[model samples]
Target: MHDLIASPFLNSFVVLRPGRLEGIALPERRFRELAQSHGSGLAVPLWLTDAARSRWGIDVAPRPVSHAVHIRDAPVYGHSRASWEINLGCDLDCEHCYLGEKRFAGLDAEGKQRLLLILRDAGVLWLQITGGEALINPHFAASCRLAHDLGMMVEVLTNGTRLTSPTILESLTTSRPYRVTVSLYGATAETYDSFTRRRGAFRRVTRGLAAGVEAGLPLRLALIVTAQNAHENDRMRGMADELGIPYKEYTHMSPTIYGGAESLASQSPAHLKALERFTGCNAGHTFLHVDPHGRASMCKVGRDEQIDLMAEGVEGLVRLGAIADRLMLRTGGCSGCRLSGLCSVCRPLAKRYQEAKAPLNTYCQHEQKGDSG
Candidate 1:
């Protein structure tokens, strides 16, 4: 990765460092000047050199623009963020996975590279690479490196089971992700292993966590509270505390993305937290999601309409905003509901619950409505 990444983020321009959360915004003229300077073999600007020294404690003196800065081209699309499921495969089988069936399949190395370039060209500044477990994918490291080199800050979502692998650790520490979020199932070995149905899972995860912390990775914990592991919620918090890392708890459960209700069986009834009121969101307007097979959707929960990226390329994204609008309409079971305004989830998510025939109380506040399908 270059020392700094300069790129256009929708209407604005930004400079970011890999693995760092902080960023510097630049005016359009200044950004264009840098681009021109790089093209003309001019020296790096003093302002950027000073900004690097003060903000990140790095001295970039007398370096050419081509060497010190990597600039990205502006995109036709206004999108600035996206999430891609690199592969829908995991090492452990958790009881409440939203993916439902975790199959090992996705694009090949060349296809993956093409997709990343498409995302870069689409002006995706922040990209989340996820999976059944992102680390298990053979092309994950290469993808991460390519994304960083292309001026996008990457975040990886993993289960922490493979953090102990020297190869995985070296790859991440070298290229570095802005964040690596790991799922925390339980505090104890028995509870964790039981929940995931994977023997020795807790041991491997703990070791991986230690390795990540020691390597000074930007790590966060996602505490997954379910019926099998709800009793250990407090202990799980303590575990995150002991590691000196930040964490967030997930008490509510949703049906599988494919509208399968099987994953809901693990919901902890007593521990379910009230969801925040649903306001508006930008879903397909400013962000998009891509499945393992290079299918792009509005978001993870609202995937009724998808564009096959491998088939149509980034040009396929042109129709996504319209799809988002259609999916948001209150039709079908939600048509003319008295309490539609107070619903906590968007239409696409509520549709999934309805398809799964989930308990009304699990998602809806109103009493029984006949034939929601």
Candidate 2:
């Protein structure tokens, strides 16, 4: 997959041209099928051709040109930090939402201000606004403008219910969001409506998507996976394909310890484990969730989210973020396990392990079941 001749052009020292890529493992048959399907298996990024890269304004290749141990020694296409959730108060009672209904039940005014201040001062280059529904917040537009003014691109993740207005569109469009991610529950009304429990919500989400597309805004899709709907992941993903929106699927993984999916958190361990393989707790590194109560966690689940940002303040928390980096680099347990593409213990899960001596993982159990079969 990596060729030495291609290293100089694509290595850490030299930046890969926006659209140019030198190393890719597309040489395999199975991988080729995946490429023609699921985007080159995350190994090869679906990239624009060389000429197209010039227009897209990106220099990072979707695939690596080299196999460097250190990211510093490897090529980087994006910024160092990631877009994190600062607000959690939401109005919708989404059955599969990671931000449980209680979290978004409401937000204290003081807590909101504290989070905004933290994001603004953290040298954060990209800020994402999410909530029960970020757009519903009274000061949503003003807040978006504030973040945009700070020389950072603002990204919004919403249910698309409140964005059905001209003014809302204007405010968001003016901000030039990195992308507006809309959750697509199902391809059909019956399927989607049943899950959201909002009769006309499916229609509204579709309409909002059309308006966003017409406005030339980028769109991403979030598909929730539950026991009732787990078998339909591929089907929902196909819907995103039809809509031309990149989609990701998430299972309501509360595991009891982290307020998992209300009634089904205790789904068979085997099923939970399968999701864990791909949906492993990437909390500390991949995401940093902020709740309405001003609680913070690298991941949404895990009781250790006891890390209160309102108490620590932004300075202390930014410093603490390095802990996530350390936790990610760790190579043990699920994290350290040498399974190909298995989910490891995210920060939240690690906290669980420390707090409770029990190993109640679905992934491990699922694999064991397969062995028995």
Q: Go through the candidates in order and give each one's C-alpha lDDT.
A: 0.90, 0.52
Root-mean-square deviation of every model = 2.2, 11.9
lDDT of 1 by residue, 1-373 (tens): 3788889887789988889989999999989999998877788899999999988898767888888889988889877899999999898999799999999999999999999998987789899999989998999889998998888899999999999988899889988999999999999999999999999999999999999999999999999999999999999999999999899999888899999999999999899888876776888978999999899999999999899988998888899999999998888888878777778888898999999999898888685344343
- Model 2's number of clashes is 13
Checking candidate 1 for backbone clashes, the offending pairs are none
* Model 1 TM-score, 2 decimals: 0.96
Consecutive 10-residue window with the lowest summed lDDT within model 2: 68-77
Model 1 worst lDDT window (10 residues): 364-373
Q: What is the lDDT of residue 96 in candidate 2?
A: 53
Best candidate, lDDT: 1
